[model samples]
Target: MSATVQTPTTRPQIPVTVLTGYLGAGKTTLLNRLLTEEHGKRYAVIVNEFGEIGIDNELVVDADEEVFEMNNGCICCTVRGDLIRIIGNLLKRKGTFDAILIETTGLADPAPVAQTFFVDEEVRAVAKLDSIVTVVDAKNVVARLNDSHEAAEQIAFADVILLNKADLVPAAELVALETRLRTINPTAIIHRTERCMISPTEILDRRAFDLDRILAIEPDFLGEDAHEHDDAVTSVALRETQPIDVNRFNQWIGTLLREKGLSILRSKGILDLKGSPNRFIFQGVHMLMEGDDGKPWGQDEARDSKLVFIGRDLDAVELKAGFAACVA
Candidate 1:
């Protein structure tokens, strides 16, 4: 009798949403609402203990960087040895939960947390990057944006940004703050709220990783191309109509990231490669980058590549020259 060989079952990708905000932006309050609210969804929250967040759920993990199997049948682990390990452990018990929400430290950059889903193969296969929801203190954003680049970065990387504490400021002030945020990241969906009052659907299950939607959402920075600066941190957009040599482009980007990753808060690009019929889309946080083939270039459409870099003190002349060298 011939032995039957069986293949491993592939689990459906669970969405992981990252929640970020400044220290006093009511992130904890919003998180508390998500946890204690009567919403039917179950969440495994990885929170910082120093923050005054109240997690009443049985799946609430400890603050330390260690792994533990909880009594509630949920896997609990701190974001140690990379989120890949903790997330991999969670996937092992995929039957216990519906989704995952990770709350980064206040004043922390969301890039590292966002990069985890892209950098790890195992985690990427079983989980989809839902969206990054950044909660901002509307009354304090002016001072915050000026005080720290971390504040600016949190705002820039957001898929959905919540202007919390909106009641504290006047309507005109609110409009002005919104305009400032839009200039930094015109693509993000902004919602004004009092005390972080936002619907769960607005943030959850957002297919942000879908490149086709991303292409439409990214703002047309090329037309005006007026450089906006938030202290040392700023955003740079690069566009070229020519197709690039794949190997040379990769080499340049790899080295660039290695040397300047610390300064680069976030990076994203859509490429037109010389030999490839399909478009190449890539984004990175610091030195870690992930890229894949996106949609095909139609015969009638113009073959143009666009790249955006959000960093501190990025040399446009040098970077643009490096990119131009890669033109096929």
Candidate 2:
């Protein structure tokens, strides 16, 4: 006669928040807010290597990445070996952090990252994907949606969306944008924020990842459907040693937007502008752009200009030529 062994009714599972947003959508701002808030919950953050110089990582708490395609060549049905290994190690000393946060690169489709939670038995046993929180640039999401599949997928996969930079847009536009978001992801909770200033409680520990609902929406959330990335969309990183001529840079950018704004999804740069001791940081989505003075150059800091562009059918040579022409 053998006595039945009772398995533990409940096991401790760490809550994870998968944070996503398109380029220049202020994901790092939201992430920084979450980390600095006195919410009494410590989080182990994992950020993707965002820029050529790790500028985004420099703004965040930590960083990491490694992606692979499954045997079936479906890009969406993929996994990150680094993610698994990191989480596995974290699980060993789980008490150190109360939760985990994964901030994906701007161009990333959250499907593969979210699938990691469902596909890995070891990770699944110890971690619960609490929710997918997407930070949207309220001022630019409309333009983004028209040209970016990743942007649309990010919205579709979100459990909560921060309609960030709401103050930048008019109220009527905000209402219309919210209505548009509802059409894409009616189930997600949308919160308006000027700078991702929301209670951590509202965004964290929600236990809001509804797999059944996601399946009903995506049917293939578990990756039965073969999907591939849009090879047409590409990123270009440019570096310039000489300080850029402000007038030349503006004229060139304006002309470029006029000629290729439809293909240009996003653009960002930290510039060493002629006659400015401070760093000029600028980011744009399609025809819209904004810029402001960043911190003054440190005594030992490099003053070289670094720019990145993500778009469809971008001409690297033409872009490089144009950037070179901006040198002061």
Candidate 3:
């Protein structure tokens, strides 16, 4: 008789949802609902600040929360190490839980967390990115978007956006705010909810992540790791319709970051390069910057260049003048 070979069963990949938003944007409320709701699936939650008396821990049900400190107070720079370690350990207990949820600090940029799933081979084998869900404060999101780069990033990276506290704002204001959100991220699905009350079907197991869109937003999705942290960070936004001299902009930004990278936390831009059919996207964390060509410009689309810099004591005039000098 011939010997029979038995094949081992493959374990199903776990789904992970990254929860984020600006401070006081009802993230904790949403978290509480997710944990307490009778969704018939067990979830292991990872939080930035685990056991603080008055914060998320108190509101959540009794469960083990993994706490990790940001390296040099920068989530993008530091989370990779801790997240990989935590997730590696979680895989050992496979089949005990149905999914994983990560709630980031209000100031965090979700890009790094999302990058982890794609960067790590072990984690990638066991877990699949479900979506990035952002909770927004309907009354204050506009102001936050204007002043905070983190707030805008949370919105930009989200696959699902929760416009929380909808009762506090008028219908007209909500409409306008959502319109503004679309300009920043046209692909996300925005849901209006009060006190974060929503059906589980809307958030969990949706499998809404699109890697192609992420590459469009972050040109170097698989490239070098990024890091950041600072006090009194300010933002400068520049927009122009005319094509820019790529050589001039490259020289200027390279010199500027080399000289002043310490003060700058983050810089990002989408450019209409001279004589190019495709859009140019670039992202920088401190001194390290990367860029690549993005999707081709639509025939009817307005060809515009937009850039934003977030840092401490930014000289808006100098940055604007430098960008203006790059116009072709």
TM-score of 3: 0.58
lDDT of each: 0.74, 0.73, 0.71
Per TM-score, the best of the predicted structures is: 1
The candidate scoring highest on lDDT is 1
lDDT of 3 by residue, 1-328 (tens): 8696544456678999889997688887788788778878888777775423333222222323332433432222323556777888877875678888888878887756765665567887888778889999999987787687788778766778999999999999898777666545544678999999998778888753332333244212212212122224445567666899999999999888877866665576788999999989876656556678988889998788877665667787888889999999
Candidate 3 weakest lDDT stretch, 10 residues: 219-228
lDDT of 2 by residue, 102-163 (tens): 98889887766766775667887888778889999998987788787888768766778999
Candidate 2 positional error at 172, Å: 0.9
CA deviation > 4 Å runs, candidate 1: 1-9, 32-41, 56-58, 65-85, 118-125, 209-230
Report model 1's TM-score to 2 decimal places. Answer: 0.79
Q: What 10-residue stretch in candidate 1 is worst by lDDT?
A: 69-78
The residue-level lDDT of candidate 2 at 272 comes to: 91
lDDT of 1 by residue, 1-328 (tens): 7697544575578888888998889888877777776768888777766667566676655443333222211212112344667677777775787888877778776765666566556778987777888999998888888887789889878878999999999999998777778666655788999988878777777764434434543335523433443345666667677999999999999888878877876777889999999999987777777788987999999888877777778787787888888899
Q: Over the full model, what C-alpha lDDT does candidate 2 score relative to the true structure?
A: 0.73
Lowest summed lDDT window (length 10), candidate 2: 218-227
